[model samples]
Target chain A: MPEYTFLVVEDSPTMRQLISFALKRIPGSTIVEAGDGIDALKKLSNQKFDVILTDINMPLMDGLKLVSMVRNDPTYKDIPVIVITTEGADDARERGISLGANAYVSKPIQTQDLLNTVNEIIKSKA
Target chain B: MAKDSDSLSKKVENFLKVFKKGEEFTQELLQENEKLRYRLAQQEEVSKSSGRGEALNEQALEERLKTLEDENKSLLDRYHQVEEENKDFANRYIEVETENNNLANLYVASYQLHSTLDFNESLKIVLEIVMNLIGAEEFSIMMLDEKTNELSIVAQEGMGQDARKSIKMGSGIIGQVAKTGDAFYRDGDPTNLKGIDYTHPLVTIPLKIKEHVIGIIVIYKLLIQKTEFSNVDYELFSMLAGHAATALFSSKLYSQSERKLTTIQSFLDLLKEK
Candidate 1:
């Protein structure tokens, strides 16, 4: 099995830690943490990642804009993207999907569901 | 037989030592493989069974979600109710504190009014009560002579030079309250001073002891901070009307009797000496 690197973008330190912890359960999983979209973009420019997990609401640039940026770009466009947000509205989920998000997970997050979704997206891409 | 047993033991120890090398690694790999196979089989069974159980699981989750939402709403309502109760308690506490302070001020003012037999000192106390307790900066205390049927200013403070030193019964706002023995408060209504220059008198309280109106206290204006008078101020005015009058009258009679006793003592001594 190939070593999978995941980029976790969330403003809250606790949520970032939770995502990293869950991802660590999978063998050979590597995680990079970013506070917001701008930091995530900088990290993306520096390294290659197999998957990106992001939150919708952030300080400088939101996850929607990040998703759009990733989808528009040529080099990193193929990277699997998953959106985790407090916004559970249909329109918000639809917007994330239209912007090329592979999956949408609402907050009050179900940890098992999130892990399974991550696994599924990664396997599908593989 | 003992030699055979020792040889078997040595064989077992040697076998254990061999097992500690690369054989341990192979055992661990086999155990891990068994665990993986078990997990994979469990996953396959779950996937097959989930086709039938998915709807039931979804229904249970929906019910749980609804219960949580209702609980959250009820907790939110309880929080708002507690906040309202706290606000009401705070308002009630402020009202109770104000009433207590007002009663204390009244007691202190009553005590000051009758603390001394000196008429001048009693009068000074009344002035202090008006300025400090009542928040009035400008006012006048006047005495009504029964024989002449005239009112004269006994103690005055913060008054304009143009203010009249005396007013007849039934002449203006002050005289009307004095004539009828009724307390009058016309705050912000300056049209009632009748024929007198606008000195902006706020209220006129008739000082009465038993049915006789002894004098009147005219409040001209409050201090800068006090914009208007409250019901509590009105209650204070009524209290002063009764208590202040009795204090002044008693102090005056007491001093007069003391002077008369002194004179009698002097006359009696002179006669006894002769």
Candidate 2:
């Protein structure tokens, strides 16, 4: 089955739930939530996801470090890591690239852009 | 007459060697008679007139001759000293110029080695060249493995298999370069790089693309040289890292494109069958 599986790495439960709800509105989709990189890694070891949406700031591990860890790992390196945060700065973008993040989306994201971008990357990545 | 004869006799005694070997003795002997006659008249006048001006002229001539002789001696001494100094200077300049040429050659060679395509080949060539050029007895190029995603010694020089196998990224100078994406140097550090004696000055350059923290290039020069890692090393290693990235990216892309083309062809075949 050509189903869309998304792994959302966010520290906030409310934001996670909110994003999950919005993502569910899209057809042919399933959602998995991880609180941090460590959690994300645990889930990643078990199953593969179509996209890895991560947050910049987290307790156990931040999004940038997670992306680097993912990119460094041969198994998970190819997965696209989109950094979701309230920050948008040159340094942040440069840092994200260095850490091997695929792309970036600002926080308080509009549900429409998120859905559209997710679809596009999954489509292109596929 | 006797007084004049005695003075002339002393003059001849002083210059006996000068006249002894010379020719034309008959003409000089006739000249001496005229000089004696002049001296007889001059001495008579010296007793009569003040004769001070004539004495003064003679004294002036003697003083001038003394000064000229002293100046000639001084010039001879100076000539010898300058000759010695020029020789010393030439030797020193040759030594410095030779060293500079050697360093320039090494820099060019290192740059060429850094330009190579294969990672292991580049590392092996770089470490060996650095060891030879910089006289680093112990050397390694620890890289972050693309597959394992961990810093590992993919290629190393001047080491046994076990020694090479033990080096990992984030562990020593090489590892720190991979971890921090910056160069560091520690001379006989408080905490040494394990296994390798802390007997050399370690030069580490972070193999980074922007801030990727890819790996480290270490040049372990002798311990006593007081040579520290510089922007120069970072600049060189970073250039090598840039080349490494192109090689890596090209290989990755080539494989991916090859696979994509294969997949698309297979799909097309299925469509044709249908």
Candidate 3:
């Protein structure tokens, strides 16, 4: 029973809550919220996180920039990143993965799909 | 001397006969011993072969047992794998069921919205649909005033009092959509809640009866966790545009008819008194 700390970054409170709700279903999972990419970076600096789930579109900084920054940083670079993309944003999904995101989930998200993606990334990393 | 020689010969002859008989008897005994030995050897060979056959059978049984044990282990492993697969499928089925339930709830909510003929109740239902189903945090339902040619807020949520100003027809985004009967959706990310002007809402659905626009549903911002509008949201919007307008219109007409009926009844009563 390993404890997992997750950093969820999204501009919309509703989406963040939904994703967090799904993530909380995993046993021993601790969730931390961020409104955008900048806020995510701040949280990353404060403490270690096992996985990062971020929405691609945001007010100040989008998820792609955050992913690239995380990938570049020596400390957080190894942490798995899962990008949340809108349903039709195929280009953005590809770009996010190319930018070093481990995996992704489309918007209008199915809770099961999101969970499976996160669980897979976490298991692979473990 | 002749008599003694004859007697020696007779004695030799008898001794020879007796010696021959003894030799013949000894030869017979030796032959019997050899036959017995051959028989013993054959019996010993048969007994040794029986023992060897038993050993081979034991070895074969041990090998068969080992093979069966291995097969049993493999079958057990396969059984566990199948069990795991079944559990996975069950989990997936439950998720699908939950999704179906949510969609059903939305359907029921929409049905209830149209069932009501009361204007206020219609507004309440619309608010619930927007807030709960659409995940709108800041929104307002503005009805078009035919006389004034303006759109006024009939019901609102999460907006300041000062923000609820009426818009002239074809004036701003909400008004233009109301005038044209075309829905207004902001380009790019709906969740990007930075510098949101109340005039330009995230979505402005013109509630229409055919080509005629009756009212507008303006959503300035969505709830924090709502990343983007889903397919169901689009469907909901399409539904509200037509059904909500008809409900509100019918209810208003019903209210007006009730008022006229009341006036006519009072006049009849007055005439009877006179």
Fnat of each prediction? 0.00, 0.00, 0.00
**Model 2: per-residue Cα lDDT over A62-93, one tens digit each:** 88888888999999888888877553345766
Proportion of true inter-chain contacts also present in candidate 3: 0.00
Report the lDDT tens digits of candidate 1 across residue range B63-166: 65566556555655655565565556556555654564455455556666767778877787777677655666668999898888888899988788888898
Off by over 4 Å in 1: A1-126, B1-50, B189-200
Against the reference, the lDDT scores of all candidates come to 0.75, 0.60, 0.79
- What is the C-alpha lDDT profile of model 1 across A1-126, one tens digit per residue? 678999999876545665676677566899999999999999999999999999887899999999999999999999999998643256777888999999987653445567789999888988
**Each candidate's TM vs. the true structure?**
0.53, 0.38, 0.47
lDDT of 3 at A125: 88
- Write the residue-wise lDDT of candidate 3 on B1-274 in tens digits: 2244345546555655655565565556556555655655665567577766555645555565566556555655655565565556556555554565345445545676777678888787778678755777789999998999999999999886557579999998888999889998897767655746787789999999999999999998776668788766887799889888888888888888988999999999999999
> Candidate 2: where are CA atoms >4 Å away?
A1-126, B1-58, B73-92, B114-120, B145-149, B160-173, B188-201, B219-274
Full ranking by TM-score: 1, 3, 2
Question: Global lDDT for candidate 1?
Answer: 0.75
DockQ for each numbered candidate: 0.01, 0.01, 0.02
lDDT of 2 by residue, B148-173 (tens): 75755555555544454434556655
| Ranking of all candidate structures by their lDDT, best first | 3, 1, 2
